[model samples]
Target: MQRVPKAALLGAGALAIVLVVVVVLLVAGGGSDNDNKNAAAPRGGATQKQGNGDQGDAKPDASAKPSLTGSALPNGDLSNTRDMKGPITSGNVKDLQAGWSLALGQESQSQYGSYAASPVVVKGVIYSQDLASNVSAIDLKTGEVLWSQQYASPDQGPNGVNVGGGRVYGATADSAFALDQKTGKEIWSRKLIRNAGEGIDMAPGYHGGLVYVSTVPGNNGKFYGGGTKGILWALDAKSGKKVWSFDTAPTEKWSKKNEDINLGGGLWHTPAFDGSGGMYFGVGNPGPFPGTDDHPWGSSRPGKNLYTNSLVKLDAKTGKLKWYYQVIPHDIYDWDFQNPPILTKVKGRPAVVESGKVGYVVAVDRATGKLLWKRAVGKHNGHDKDPFYASKGQYSKLRLNEEIYPGRLGGVIAPMSTDGKYVFAPVVNNSVTFTGQDKDQATDGQTSTGELVAVDLDTGKIKWKVEFPTPAFGATTVTNDVVFATTFDGVLHAVSAKTGKTLWEQQLPASTNTGVTVHDNTVIAPAGLAAGQGQTPAIVTYTLNGK
Candidate 1:
């Protein structure tokens, strides 16, 4: 949840040659006409308006429903959402008390904290994984362990499992695997990495009869050590067989000519399905980001990297490209568009919404990929405009050591959640100082201050925002009228969804950078960074103190 071992501040990027663009045109409904124009980001600032900006009906698409199905949180089509169909109410949320806690063991320790993903619940079992990609099943009522499958393979962070078709799906550092939902024994594990530079860390997704996983650029403990990489793969869920693979950065082969000097492309969060055979996911950044002393200003990798920092949709059944809208072009900072895309309706039209390290929440037409509206959230200190300047060939004036809002670590590092009417995004205001290009790194040793910004789905405007002292790394989870957010320091807060008023708060056993989940009458959070800060790793649960 904090910075990973390698230079990847965030996971997610875009670029293209003819092959990629032709592949791109297959999804061309979403891309801009050319490189420079795309990099300029059309409506690139805060409180911006785009094609038909959706001020139309001023209501959420009524067909959308909050997921009670345990696939994280379902969107209109569903990725993750704050709204829940659970019985937890604002009145009783304030009455919650500690239910149970399960302390983790040595096997759970990882460089980056484990337990970073929100657990999935099916029947009465909770399915979760840690940083090393170890998964376990725990009883929903009692905190007793049902089954544990330990890979102990050190993963970066944000990896978890999905349950569907009567099986649990997940990934280790280099493979996609499935487990018997009842026994926790391995059903099938398939190796999916293309090169040593690629690994898997995202929670796998399920649709139709297939389990889907994506490749991220990482190896050993280093991040982005390969050429433009991230690829998305869909596998037959029943047999664990490969189905289709889509490269997030198609132009890397054509542009870099197979050189491994620069790294690009990857998906950080899981994906949201449109339910009509369409799937949506965000893509990550290009590198050596901001460039080294020699390739300062990203000179080596030119042109708007197509799929990186973009929101894309594909024909889930065929892995065919549908539409792609590059969110940031030629990104110089660690702006990843890799948050799970929430499929919902805005202005009564089917729209897909996403936000990431770029700190802006955006909504677009689900079918045509047309921009609907964009709202800048958190503290945006003009760094977003750098891409536009880079588009104009004036990016040489990049500042060094200046306190940029939404720094490499700033922005929305985790996925956001949504109610039918509003999207709740976790905002991290961490900053990074770009050392002169002589060194290929930016430095920042500070913890972050964050907040939750609520954006109206129809108007694309800020409805309300609540601040936090610690970084709110977890994705927001909402019940009927309550919004639950977990700060990295382990404090979980319950707020009124309508007024942004604090409803309840509880201190967890240890530090956590993951998300919170609401099921039935209980609230569950997993914490396992058991190192310092007077804390220990454990799965913590809470319920109303008294009936």
Candidate 2:
């Protein structure tokens, strides 16, 4: 990964602290009254209501059989050859000898909100964070809530939740926390220095004995008025003690003189780790003010802005930068390059594939950030195009118009799913452009519908793509060679992963962002409706074979 210069690094640090404080206060101040309103509810389907007893210890039905028996396309790479062991196969369900069942649970409101943070399943216990600022533990087999605890600060966003070594780690605003996974008890918490006004929207990546969390400066107080920078922390997983810190942007003496150059790129996504101890992640849009004069377009500051919009490889043990590939050089649009870089193989090569807001699916060498192939997956409008390639920071006078593809939400809003043979990409269609001074005053410009696309993992060819009437926000889950996704119209549909054929469809109460999770014969989704309405978000579980 490239390193930001010293002067710029200092400014970014100051900006990050201020930004986190402001975003926290803003989040904490605004939504307290209606916090409970957005809580999740149960979906209307074949659900098992927990009886008046210890919900966690409920026994599974003797007739219930496991629905899914397979492995996730291990580490995002398809060609790596993992020992597949799940009940699902590539053939049709009717061709199988065994029958399956689905069960629904309306206990929890929402599973995970907004971003695509994969839920952690440890020791048959599932753990995930909710939009309501609560961490919940549920029985994987039965949709029974084991324990849940809400945080005092409503503004704190629990971006990442992971369970390892009997401890669960999560990041809320500028602080990182550890809790007992079984009992949901706090082990310890640590407060990091964030930018005064910007919010830190990142999940912590856990590997080996350390936890890696990303932070953005400038969100401590109000709005993100001040500039921000990106910082990564390595902490002791159990004790919550700092091990080492890597500043993507390092401070410099002359940074104060040039405020535009002082802005640091924000790290808004969780870092991905290779089993061999390599870490990978991307950065968010550049700030304090985007599209400004000081930091002209396509300017790459050495050291300080090393990994923004760039896929970075780092040593997990030492927190050292190894390699990087910039997806968009000096990104202009708010096209954050922070989507989880799914580690998968393409064409029998060990590769890492990532879908960015720019609407491009890039496959690169996992060991070395070498570009293998790049394909535009979304519609391109041709906005800014330049033929001449100038060196980084050397402003080129050449201007060309290029089509803008994918348009922010059109790219991979959800994580990519694979059955080793094919990759399923959920293309979001929420074409509503938000423009306003504040969130409340923002206008919903237009509504762009969403789609689910199946691509050949080996050839990058489209197998089949299905468009949805309403926008689909949650990630897709696969089992028994069938893919499942939910939309805002309160509908759940299951499609064949191999042929993209609709196998099952059902309607619920509202739109859902929580991705579907499958355990045994049951499929679960967490969802909610718009605010001020009499609807609450819910965790709807469904049994595939209903009476």
Candidate 3:
């Protein structure tokens, strides 16, 4: 997302803050510590390591079973890969033919709304939402609409949709709801957040009879204007009633006595739930960006900004903070820890992997939040040039207008995929010049490149990387032999997963910023929303010509 630059109330410094907010939207886990009585079991299970990074001879936890509502890939069940497994073999995916196409909603540039999420396909039906948060269910085989529901508010664009507890779940600007899966009739809709300026922008997660939704502030300080804020909420999946809520920003440490500038730390992605009742979520950055005049370095509402720009694990049933790992503390770069933390086994040990706008992908011990290994995946000019790249004492340098590679929009912003052994991440490489003017708000007009890199989950080592002509957004899907990546320019490229060789490519209807889902012999994806490019939101399907 892009924005018009804003000027600071106090002058240039204010504009710097304004400049920072635009980059904030460009886009956008863990476990441990405290305690959750309902937590399944310490994620630490004993195992034997093999010479390969893949899990080998690991004793399986009888309790760890496939999460029916977890992310589903066409290859097989996502949970079946605890040993770093992958599709048995790449199917006959080559020589494809376009299947049925459906228009979910009209893309609106004025509203900044587009169909940007991957559709949820379950039980022979496809569930999705458009930029306006219009919810719909379509037949998986025939692009026929089963049911459609529209929204009047532009703020209601849904980030994604989920299905569980015999209902379909989705979150709009400020509310979370569940609709009858078959009828599309609203079962219950709850305003999870009071401030209209704050809304839920990630797909809801379900487990143990509970549904989870996270909130993100409106663009361009809509949150600050309404004196709004952010939080993580849990609800009864069956009834949409509030269960427990966790404030991303707390008043005790993050507030200004006289001002209303305390904000930021929006959750912009889906929460990962371990079957054991441990939930992992990533928190966004702190507010007023760059820094306000009062606090030049953006440390105004400070104290490590508990929970902001960190990976948090909570007890699924009680929303109790268990443990957290802050990736970027007092983040001035708007580097959101917005990516999902993937729960998997590393060398026979339970581990969590996450990557963010900082270009570094990390693996941590699930129960302890201890670093296993961190590797820089995306391309960057150099970290030495980043003003806030200091490993220690980043707060000392609160200077304004410093340049950085993998600059706000340059790092990895989309979701990554992982087979039991390797993690597939789509990388965005570009240089961002932060100018606090209404003109150059962000990478609104900058050029960016993309790369698809495969990293060994066990060693954090790069196996193979393929670069592209345009920057990549959305999610990456992997089959046994092919890795599917959609570029910002609407080109869906299928590269050989084992060798990074180009296998096939298809041009979509519009700029695509989401991932491609291949189920069985069919591939499903949605196209809309490209920063400066106008949108024509549509769901595109592709199937093996003969299949």
Candidate 4:
């Protein structure tokens, strides 16, 4: 997917999950399409906050806040976000009723099932992409398809579109293209990928005049075995010509000489803008991960993987690195810092906040790239230090399977939402155990649970955390008072942003690996994907029934 505005930073989420997961095979062999950023390992569960020296050009604009109409959602470039203060409050959310249902395609026909893209509502039209990367325009009020751009794209998700500069932008398996916003006609297309093992799946971010699209190391629903490096590109929005490109992979000293040991970084979501021509994104993880049998504990890939699993700030016009703060150093467990870099003002200071599968949400000075604060969400098992110990051959079999919090299918696997003061995250707590630091197979403990956490943007302290029965995926959407999240059980939960209490919940027709959109009195939920035996993949829209 691809456009933010004229210039925008990239945005979140990870993993190609199913109704059930066998992570061992997915990690040690053919990477079951899955996924994050790690720079430096924070010594403890949290990092301290600080002021910065770079009083850069970033200015706060509430009007420029990500919304559905006009611009995109705060995180909605293939993920989700919103600007309108939602009307469904904790008190009134219980009155919501199913309003309209739209099916993108049949579960059998699509590989990734139904919709993975968050619906982008601009003006009165809703722009959405399906599992096949098909773009559609619908009437926001009546739920009618206005135009459809047909495609045969693979179900490599988080794929979606960005509507700006009179064109809608999206990508297929190997190419990126632009479409007329009104007529749905193809304008300019660029071939961005050369192989199935590595391609583009994230929604492109747009701002000022350039569009940002990055290459991911995945082949449809599977990951590249090895040697695939990711690239971030700033393309000319008008001609689809590359303005600049940045290599996400850093040149590292291979632990095994002359071996193909590098599987580099990419993006899971679109980027966010810093108002001051700076584009921000959470970089993906490095691979040949955890370790192969011989290269135990990722010994073949050692040291801090610069730019990988880190928050990279770049000059939107030049693509030059401004600053970066790594969350996990030499990440072995796919703890990607892959959430949308949400921009907000804390105590009059501009800050960028992000969260990844590492289950840690971090905030940094927007201009200085200095750590403001960091807090751990969900669960932790100290497995984050395994790569360090094992990388140095201090391997201990006693530590095997002992650490599994934020496991293979766990942590913050979806995009997060923010309403200035607090950030809302959808976290999956599926515990996964590995045979050892040197082993390839990982076993799922199957203790999969979920939570919605509210973190104070300024202090990095968790304000509240609401638990759920099953894992939640996709993006977290919030109005003024209520936070909206979707669970793997296909239930949409409306939680109190202030209290972390579930105010209302509704079950859909099927399971979900997607997000929700809230506009005015309506909450649009994409209840498509992994439909039950009798259910059809449908996008369910709920309206306040009696309010």
**Which candidate leads the pack in lDDT?**
1
Against the true structure, candidate 3 reaches a TM-score of 0.81
lDDT of 3 by residue, 21-109 (tens): 33333321011121111211111112211111111112222124333222322112323222212232345556677777665344322
List the global CA lDDT of all models.
Answer: 0.69, 0.49, 0.60, 0.65
TM-score of each: 0.87, 0.73, 0.81, 0.85
lDDT of 4: 0.65
Kindly indicate the candidate among 1 and 4 with the higher TM-score.
1
lDDT of 4 by residue, 1-547 (tens): 1100000111111233433352221111111110101111111112112111111112333324533333353254322334345567777888987676665454213555656677666766667777666777766666666667777676456767876777787887677888777767788999886465677777777776677888876655556446665788888988999999987765344434523656767887778775577788888777666766666666677777667788988888999999998987777766667766777766668777777777888888888989888888888876766656654667673255564787766777788887767788888776766675422355655556778888887788888888876677667888778888887666778888889887887777666777777766877777555444545566768888822
1-547, model 1: which lDDT tens digit per residue?
1243111225532111111211211111111111111110111112211111111111123245634634332221244454556778888887777776776666765666556676777666677777777787777777666667878787776777877666778889899998777667798999987787677778887777777788887644556664637888899988998999998877564256535666677777677776577888998877666766656666666778777889998998898999999888887776888788887789788888888888889999998999999888888776777876765568565777776777666688777777778888888777667776522345552656779888999999999999987667677887788988877666778898898999888776666677777777888877655434346667778777722
Off by over 4 Å in 4: 1-19, 22-68, 73-83, 107-110, 251-259, 391-393, 397-399, 436-440
Residue 207 CA displacement from its true place in model 3, Å? 1.1
Weakest 10 consecutive residues, lDDT, candidate 4? 1-10
| Candidate 2 Cα deviation (angstroms), residue 528 | 3.8
Off by over 4 Å in 2: 1-118, 155-158, 217-224, 249-256, 259-268, 288-290, 293-305, 384-405, 430-445, 529-534
Candidate 3 displacement at residue 542 in angstroms: 0.8
lDDT of 2 by residue, 186-244 (tens): 88888775656544545566667787676665442443343456678899988989998
lDDT of 1 at 378: 82
